[model samples]
Target: MTQDWNNIPTSHQIPHTRFLVDYFIKLPTQVTAFFLTHWHYDHYRGLGPNFQQGLIYCSPITARLLERITLVDPQWIVAKHNNEPFLVEHVQVTFLDANHCPGSVMILFQTPEGSNYLHTGDMRYTPDLKEEWKILNNICLDAVYLDTTYCHRRYRFPCQEKTIQRIVDIIQNSIGRDSHSNEIHCTSRHTLYLIATYGIGKERIMDALIQKGYRIYASPDKWKVLQCLEYWDSCLLNDSFTTEPCASPIWLVGWNRVAENVPGRLLPNFEALEDMLYMANYYRNKVNSSQHGLLQRVVACIPTGWTWQGNNREYLQEKDHSRLSVYGIPYSEHSNYEELYHFIAWLRPKQVIPTVSFSSSKRQPKHPFDHLLAGTQVKRAFLQKWLNNNPKESCEDDDKQSTQQLHNQPKIARKGDILSYFKASPFNS
Candidate 1:
């Protein structure tokens, strides 16, 4: 399971992401362990007290972050690092850096039956990640659980570097306009630039801003989380920031206010960001027209892959006001359709299953895409290639015998399999 919003471990009535966790509690599913790919809330939020089935594992950094933020104890979440393979109930599990977010990982599991499975948890395929997967050439991958968040044809985006440059350009242009404005009565006022960000996953953009000498300000809780990330990569953030909006040129705003558009002007935290229109009105009312010029302008930029509308990257404006501007940049944490296609081609798994899925109407992987087509072509190609490579194992065999074949096949000879095959293996101990 990748990500589930509900924290109910026992309740089977939840999203598909929690299916495995929920199923384990209802039956003797023989689930030996629960593995977390990253510290994203959707991935680990459903973990409740009822989860006593197996050992839970996450990366060292993810473990630290979870412990600090949530009720998960340090002992409950075992810390695993990249390239370290451990055995649990005759299954060999290896962790690799996901290159998506801090402490994100991809898992490789080799069963005693000699079937190999690779599950990429919320990853962006990079050159470094490509190099890391080279270690798996010795073992053939039977199946791959891929992150196909942007599997559609329209999700063509440039590299992360280009997106970063685009973001920087937007900020610079806004500042340049303010600098070069020819107002008769000019006042020294700061423009409120809000960058919409989730809890994690935009550290690179922050690093770029920090490099250009901009301090990041967020809620106290989020600031603590940023501090934890800063401990790992010093360039990712700054030590100090102010909560006051006018004090900083750039503010890291949470997604709740802008996304939900919650009413009553109540911010979640004392320093929480509220509606930009409301804030703009507050500033506008306080402005002294007789004394000087414009008081403040609020600009909100959302960095996401859904910026393209009919093959062009443009900003879609809100209806209420002109001062409150929202721009979507072509920034993404997951691989696009072309990248996903190429990644699948490179891995050449016998079977490929998308780790993430969406309803027919909802294109929001996190947020909605302008035009989302269920790109069956990529999957068709994979299926065709897989069928060509392994003719003996047809789709019929895949449908009827895949799970049973994996479990019931003759166990490969190992040091402890003969002694502890039926009983609990000594690997976890």
Candidate 2:
């Protein structure tokens, strides 16, 4: 089970390029409860008095992180950390780290009917669970809602750990290119204007930089989420001595208005970027072009996406989308094509469902049981062709039942189900 994306509020309802998508929205069901995999504005967006009667569930890291971001009172927050399962109003909700975000969780719902449902909320394939978290023990999973955004074959799929390391290397090289990486900004005000993306790849970038000796940037709101990381407290943070009152950017001047309406008025610590004015050429040329001036000026970035290929190219071609000098270095926090396919095959879920951002609709997979989204077209097509050659259902007989029917087909082949991204390994943080 990935996310209960159940609503697309009218455009002016809130802020963001896409409609808000929340898995844990309030609802009146017999299950009577919900859990948010992460504290993204989308997941937590539109939460209101509707939730007063019901309870919220999540890991401790998620609870505290959300509390720090908003002043909604910590007491109302219900927490069940990783490795611990939670029971909400008779519904057993277990927390499995999605690996997409630190506190992001996969929910297992065991209902009164004895049927079991699993929802993986925005999880990437880096799903390393505790030794005790054996899904085989479930015996049978009635249904599964997969992150089918990348279920197709066209995506560039690769090992997540390798991608993460590549991103770290890129940042280390970029920042350490200059000798005084630790040097504070002087002359003009600068805060590494790394644009703080909502969720997705933000945590990995922060973790990587901190490891490489870059101090964590902590505005009060950012400090809250960063504190949840294991080493955040012990980790070094940039020193600040500014007397200016700390204010939320969203509250004072909407981030969209920051560039146009107010620029230099922000405090010096907030503007702690470096060398862009003097070393602008080096940064631009890093990507083999002077394009992406805006992205280069941004210390870091996070772009939310369902399909890795769609979003990946979207960022890479941001120059075409906008005037911002933005270049996309492939980084994603969701599972790639190969991982999703392998996971589905491993779990062997009876029925696969797709999570969508819509309300007033019957709970159903966006696509049929055949998970054929654009991202995994290659894998799906190959599988279709292989199955066509060796029909599993019709060819089976009493003798074949004693053994395996799949003789000619490679249980797994590199070229067979591989996607475009799998060929080149775009760094997924």
Candidate 3:
């Protein structure tokens, strides 16, 4: 939920249960179990080495991170696998992959009274989510606690793989080499690539470059966290302190070291870039490489969904200075507007409760998917149209239609056709 750091509200508590997800500050006495979605600082803020709270439920990777990074008591932490149903105080709860980070999950709660609730803690919705056990089983949801971080229509961007490829292309092109070639040759000695990242996320970009035979330099603290992840390749990472500064052509810096993201603008952080250039030049001079002059060029790429400028024409935005250039690539771990729309439409939950706040004004902004919720006229009309169009169509006629139109038609023409229509719609694809 949209939590106020100063005073956390009771809205984080699930209905008909004493369990709390991603809320750990000044917890109530009635809390019997704590649920952690991931190892991000914002989600596990109040947890510490001295915490004496009850057991915390999370994924396996997150459990490892807690033991190593936060040093939370291992006795109080319970690790669970994805899609496994377990009883907590006689209530069945399951964890599903949230697809946001290493150990993020979407929690499902089923009570004895036949009520179902889903708490999606910072998730990126994908088409494969439709095949999850809960959705495939067609369980009637009582309420859905959704993550509305990028609920606006302007927040749409390309998929994660596309964005990663774009960043790799930028790096390869800047280094004066063909991206598809196995060999990378750069004539300029002053060129350096900087990738801005967070503590836990953005490993996909690093892994992509590593697969291309590029060495990356990271700090010891960052490397420690990376070792906890299951997919990290230790051969490609270099300890920054032990190795020379210019040993690797690419360096991973903090998120704010490349660009400063404000409300509606992203400006290059010239101060941080200047400091990096100075450090690189100093290290080069110490080693006496060619006894030459200082470096001149540095290219920094900041990957985030906020870089999207609401224009389909501009996938990558650039800003140029005299010696440094910054490129903001639209790489996000959160679902965009269209993804959110398709997910909600397919789930068809009875009621939706947004867990994020988008505005600071007295009057909050309107939700973008309000029209697609239950009981709305738009939903009614869409279901009605689907039922009327495919009432008595024969199997041969359905096969005769084009694949695009066939995806729009339901698989079976039955009494309650709305469910089949939604299940077979192109949006789910």
Candidate 4:
């Protein structure tokens, strides 16, 4: 999770740009424009119905959510299309689908000074992003303000599809019946499925479940949020809990209502389990006894990237009580370690500024992902190749000046000091 250090000016502001991405709290007076990457609460912490800041730029779907959920003034929101280049304060800006959620985007800023920067609010590194980069003619990025939520080496998990499939299999196996079978087996025990999710995102899981002919029950608030998504119509969602338990066996709950991760162990919320049991019993009594079986089983699945701890198992299942079984599956929307490494290597940006970390001060010295940066020699080679291919007036003189400045600077023994070298080189311009 990215720490919200509202006091850190550099953490929110893009270098040489007046725009701010995903920084709403404690709004800075110098900000020329505000950009929202998605509708997630963390990204729009300080935004509310009374938000009167400068125009907020985002995708159309996100714009709708901001108006419907946050109740922000529609006049203040500017909906930009993906891959469309527009000018903000004479700086060319474009939005690329982030592949993280419904309307998430990676903002690209290209200045007239020939400098480029990418601010990835939060992204799941996929082939689609690589294809998007190719469409931009593969311009060399000067810096990338990255979403380092899962930058650590321990965060390698299966892709979203595989994880969702595993979750489906777990639910199917727990129900003790084939999902494709048409015949219904009458038993004394009833199974209740619970999925934990945030306000937005993770709708893919619900969609997958609905595709398999399962009815989902969601809170009114959650349903309203889902209605803003493009795939809302396809979901078989019921907002009222007055229906029979078996009618919509799958229920969507808050993230913490399912399970909480402690330092050394995972603890299931027994109160939630009791509430599920109570609901099951109440529904069973309200209807004919022969119409439905007793609700005897409760299965809770918590999908998150943080649950993976270098284990080969698809999910960690624990039965704290005979009636309840909680499974923590590795389903994350953020880029994992391998994804982050490959992305940075592919871009080979001159400087990498991590956007997510425990502390802003920890970003400078002994950064956890410092090793992911391209080495000085690798950057130099890439720069030489780029300059040779895209020859421009004064290119040679600029290269020579940068090299002379590097040579004139004091000797530094750090081997892979790309940031330090770039700071001293004229290429920084």
Candidate 5:
């Protein structure tokens, strides 16, 4: 299983098999191994005391990170380099670097019966990646477990570089205006830049901030993780606004804080309640005197892909008041519709299973192969071939018939002639 940390099984419902990748659900079964895709909390949080039966497998970088987080027993972590193939219970598994986050990987599984499967664990697909990962394009896979987060037609996100540059532009523009407006009191007043980040996904954004020479104020917990991850840049500091009001420009906050309607409101883990209230009140009073007063107080920048859902644009503009402002930028780790299509077109798997459950069957479009397909794309060419191969039954019916045929076959073969067996089933070896 991949990305199933949130689905912890209760005592009533327990899984039998124990091979998992990045999912930490508790079960009664004996664990074979824990294959982690990355070091994200949602993916790696299953490493609790209740489930410690198997060896933990992850990339080297992710292993180093897990050591600092204090989630699971670090003694069990075994770092596997990318592209190295390992054997586990007669299945040959290989890992390839997934360009989603640091240490994220695409796991490929090969069985002894000459069947191959690929699981893309939260990745952003590109033409260059397709070209470089030759195994993905060269072989025909038996099945593909795909990341369908943005598999709908409406999702078209800009490249990561462009989005990062735009965010930097917004911060720098605010700083430039602050320097001009508060020149006389610049030494006394400071701008509070609230960067909404999940612990690991936005490291690239942090690198960008460091490149731009912005000092990021990190909490003790986040600071420890960052230090263990070896992000020993000069820009990361430990100074709160209450301690030095004019000290830092950027304060690394949480994702929940960015979704808040009011800026400078006291968030639980981001900062002190009194400090935030003082900053809010101080900026509200200073708005009349300084042109960049709103910028000086607080600006909430949320890096997420949900910017395209519904009326987010209107909400962002409406929330832009005197003290606090909210902006959502398109910075996603998942592949979009076009990328998913390209992956399907290239690999041409026999079956495509979505990692997430479908929302509403009524909301989805219906086609001839609606029940068989995974995403919105109606693979017409594949459908035509499938229909030609099985003319009497639909894909679902064909699956049922095949399964029934297997069950009905004799378990023990009588002394049958090899020639007769070969002639009876030409496809069989």
Candidate 6:
């Protein structure tokens, strides 16, 4: 069931919300099963309370990330790949791709009564796909729970390819060889400090940095997440550049808590006006000039810019933009507005669900479960599992199967139904 959105602030006064999964939602009936589409604190488990037992389907990456990033117990996690089906006796749970992060999955719950339901956790567009996004556009559905994270157009974002390269080029030119030379040395010896963000989503940025030969360092908490990457061997194995001892790492903390204690040491960047001022005048000036005592290296890459939202605008970009060879690489783990909208529109769910609000100016009653389930491969897995489980009932299952291949499900809305099904159920309300 739904709860008041305002309680979110007081709910978890921490830098990020301790109400990780946000508030709990209860169905009028017994909560037989649960699902975690992705491991973002906002969507998955939280400080809310105990999880109702059953099957909590998610992706392998989500499992690793959950164990590493959240308090979600390993026993509770059922890591399923895109379209992999894990049954809870009567409820058939299929883990599909949400495309939110490395291991996000959407949920497809088929009731024993033959009611088919879809929950698109949080999804986005990725260039590499076998079927132009699962090829599931034609499935007719009773209804679908959606990811309205970016339902309105205002929250749209750019494609990762364009965005990633732009950020990399800026970093390469700034941190790598500039017009002068191709050396990776900083102009100033000042620590190339950064305010780390999107522990899961932004891992790629750090990986990219390490790939380009920059020393990789993260806070101990962040390292918890880093340690869980199964494919990380390709990037970190014997690769001396991927890590630096951060026994006492500086924090890239939230801008709101600039004055608060940062455990070891917190360095504020462009999270706020004052932080930007300090960086612009103090840190930015260092990167601008190449003189710093016997240490000719000036401390560059001190974050003149902050997180993605900080760089999403002109003032933040221009004012807090990197001045020194230390570049301000604007990047994010979340799919941008365009990808969010296109993915949602393409999925065309019968119903859209509201998710955690992005910001103050950008709140919506509808959540984004659709975008979270875009590239999920769990359909195939579910089918296989179902077929194996109910061999005798193959004819019955086939009878219900729609002519539409899962990928080609048309998402057009039936008139007037939006208002009826669009609202959260009374029990949730």
What TM value does model 1 have? 0.68
| Model 4 per-residue lDDT tens digits across residues 370-418 | 3334355445556766878743334344334443442343432332231
Put down candidate 1 lDDT per residue, 69-134, tens digits, no spaces: 765656667888799898766677798888888888888877777777777878888656677777
lDDT per residue for candidate 2 within 235-258, as digits (tens), equals 534432111112100111122311
**Alpha-carbon runs more than 4 Å astray in model 3:** 1-11, 132-136, 176-186, 233-244, 286-294, 313-322, 362-367, 375-429
Sorting all predicted structures by lDDT, with the top scorer first, yields: 3, 4, 1, 5, 6, 2
Deviation from native of the Cα of residue 376 in model 2, angstroms: 20
lDDT (Cα, tens digit) per residue for candidate 5, span 1-429: 333322432111112224666666553355576677787776777565444667777887788777757456777888887888888767777888788877788888777777777777778888778665786666667666677666554555677787788778877876643343322121223456677777776778877866665556666667666665534433334321122323355667666654642221222222332355366446546554443343235566777665644222422432324445566677677886557656665565666655543443232232112233332233544566587863333445444443344334333222121111100111111
After the best TM-score superposition of candidate 1, give how far the Cα of residue 174 lies from its true spot, in angstroms.
2.8
**Clash pairs detected, candidate 4:** none
- RMSD per model, one decimal: 12.9, 12.5, 8.6, 8.2, 12.9, 12.3
Q: After superposition, how far is residue 25 of candidate 3 from its true place, in Å?
A: 0.8
Q: What is the C-alpha lDDT of each candidate?
A: 0.58, 0.44, 0.71, 0.70, 0.57, 0.44
Off by over 4 Å in 2: 1-26, 29-31, 48-51, 127-132, 136-138, 177-196, 199-201, 236-325, 357-429
- Over 371-429, each residue of candidate 6 has an lDDT whose tens digit, in order, gives 22333224544666787873333433432342223224333232212212134422131
Q: Which ranges of candidate 1 are over 4 A from the true structure?
A: 1-30, 48-53, 176-189, 230-246, 260-295, 318-321, 361-429
True-structure lDDT of candidate 4: 0.70
| Model 5 regions more than 4 Å off | 1-18, 28-30, 176-190, 230-246, 260-296, 309-315, 318-320, 361-429
- Alpha carbon RMSD to native, model 5: 12.9
Distance from true location, Cα of 34 in model 3, Å: 0.6
State every prediction's TM-score relative to the real structure: 0.68, 0.58, 0.79, 0.79, 0.69, 0.59
Highest-lDDT candidate? 3
* Candidate 2 residue 291 C-alpha distance from true site, Å: 28
Winner of 1 and 2 under TM-score: 1
